[model samples]
Target: MPGRYTLAKSVLSERKALHPSELERRDLPADAARAVRSLAAEISVTLDANAATAATLTDPALLHHIDTRYRELPATVHEAMRPPAGDTGVTIIGSIPLRDDELGRTPIDWQQAAAWAGHPERRCASYELDIVMLLLARCAGEPFGWQGQQAGRLVNNILPTPGKEHEQSGASSTTLLAPHTEDAFHPQRANLLMLGCLRNPDLVGTTVSSVRRVELDAAQRDQLSRPLLPILPDVSYGTDFPDAETPPIPTLSEVDGQHIFRFDPAYTPLDDADLDYRTAYARLTSELERVCIAAALEPGEVLLVDNDVVVHGRVPFSPRYDGTDRWLKRVNIRLPQRLRPAAEATETGYGQCVVAPFRTTLGIHT
Candidate 1:
């Protein structure tokens, strides 16, 4: 029932519709849909067996894949990436070079890519990006999703988009990024974030991440797991505009004795019960400073971050206002078996959020 949904009688009965993005307006084209189905089938076979019902769930094969492919990074590099001595919440595998066959190139802009949505991978190095997502999901033992527009640039190309960008230079003018999760507004969020660097700006823009180190004592663990902390989203991230009124979700959620975390200091609102909020915040900052490593990824190098356990940020990137600028591609995925449904199935119930749209809408009428 938690993953089920009831269908609305008709379009008129549907609640107010949220404005869909230009990309969302056009659902996956036939070929893309077929590709996704194939991918899904592959995932179902690899995962789905002995998955966790509530808390931590992982497939043995998935772990083995991560351990094996992780060797792509040098032993020294991987060892250097361990989240400090006391840290355990996050693990970062850096600068894993993909096979030459695994790499693809993107078009100069989004318009060209959209015209051939049916062959998305053909549009813009998307096939390579897809492989990156697959690897990350396989590592996290979680299913993931492709996020935003495949070929879209991080910043608006024509006019600078929101969240303050250097006007003349077209670079990030600010140094400090407000801490926040990638897509808190969406119920169906990406489980992992894969960043592939196409260019670097002034050799800056180092990534910063915070994690609740595993060595915390019982008291610290309790503090990390304290109930009902408000998670406020940065206004720039999305329209939800989270505030104090939004009930707090767990920053650290556990199941089957395995702990998982979803934290964004910028968006996470504080409640009275959050006694160690400041301490946790301070410790995280210290850990990030001490453990943060930078990889000036070449065109073919990709970095994968565990989203559920790691909060990521970027140091300021100074743009030169030239065609050559810092560029990175991101993709997200979800492990369906790890997710819990909001409610139980009724006589007529909607499925999980990802599939619920089919229940009330004219089944992919788009």
Candidate 2:
């Protein structure tokens, strides 16, 4: 049984977008989605009249309560997150409970949403959906946010910003969000990325490509593992460093017979690499593009990507910015463990820290 990530090769090509019908769909139990929605509505936790701001969202009490309160989600949800034999890493869980008026209009920008601290009415519409993302994220890992990105709010809002349609960040709509490992530059980047669609009136597709789907010769793998490239932070984080002074990191690595990867061609200074290394890197990039799959997530659908195994991006599209434009909520998650022991090292990318609101008791036997 092929998961959504294991779609037919005919559906993929360079910059080719997949129609929504071609992307496989899986639905969570209706009862479970409804129950979670109801549970979120009853939440009374607040700090200074804010229910879902950075401080309240990261509160340890609320995070633990939600995880423990409804730990037994359907098997489909857990199964969708795990890659079968690690062949692919993108999984879509759809049909969570949502209503148009309940979410209200999408926020103008992430900053506008952050300004809702003293106004409960503005944040009320999407509060439940944010909680729902937390509820789903705990099934695989602990949800976290970047201190530099969105001021460390656990859940992030992803929507197109006016006048930024051609930029490389998530706010760009007309420009293809280049394929990259989420937070590839940071040593403590997330182990999994969860994107939950709140409003996608245009059926815009999110592209995904996994390392497991490609084959590299031993020579090529060795070259890729030599820490020859340095990935810089995307512009969305509002951080920058002298590229030459930054330490190089591996585009691919192997540990205990398993593969770990870091890749961000847009941020990686390819001109700095030698001819042989660049050739190998070029091959890897070509293979990834050949296997890339574009899947459009419908409203209430959540896509979970294994950060180590997949590089995800978005296709270029025109944004209406008319309240119904494509909107998504993203969560960065930390798994129980990492492939590299050095993952524990603090290389604070631009002084940004993790905003973990909860102490997670995730099973770490993997």
TM-score (all chains, Cα) for each model: 0.51, 0.86
What TM value does model 2 have? 0.86
Q: For residues 1-366, what per-residue lDDT tens digits would candidate 1 score against the true structure?
A: 101211111111111112211101112234433343244335434443331210111235533443355345323433333222323223333333334332233323333323322252342233324334444444333333222322222111111123446221122334434333555434455545555554443444334344543344566556666555554333333334324345555556565454466665544444344447657644544554554433344443444455555555554444444344555555454444444223111101111133111012111101
What C-alpha lDDT, on a 0 to 100 scale, does residue 56 get in candidate 2? 39
Instruction: Point to the candidate with the largest TM-score.
Output: 2
Clashes in predicted model 1? 26
Flag regions of model 1 displaced more than 4 Å.
1-163, 166-173, 178-181, 184-187, 205-215, 236-245, 271-276, 337-366
Worst 10 residues of 2 by lDDT: 1-10
Residue 281 shift from truth in candidate 2, angstroms: 1.2
lDDT of 2 by residue, 1-366 (tens): 112111112223334443334344556677766766766665534323344443337665666566675466656666555532335677677668777776666767887766553256766656666777787777777777877887777888889999888766888898778788999887667888999988887778899888988878989988898877677777787544664446788888766677778988777777778988988888888888877888877788888788877999898888886787888999888876555535325344646567775535432222
Global lDDT of each candidate: 0.38, 0.71
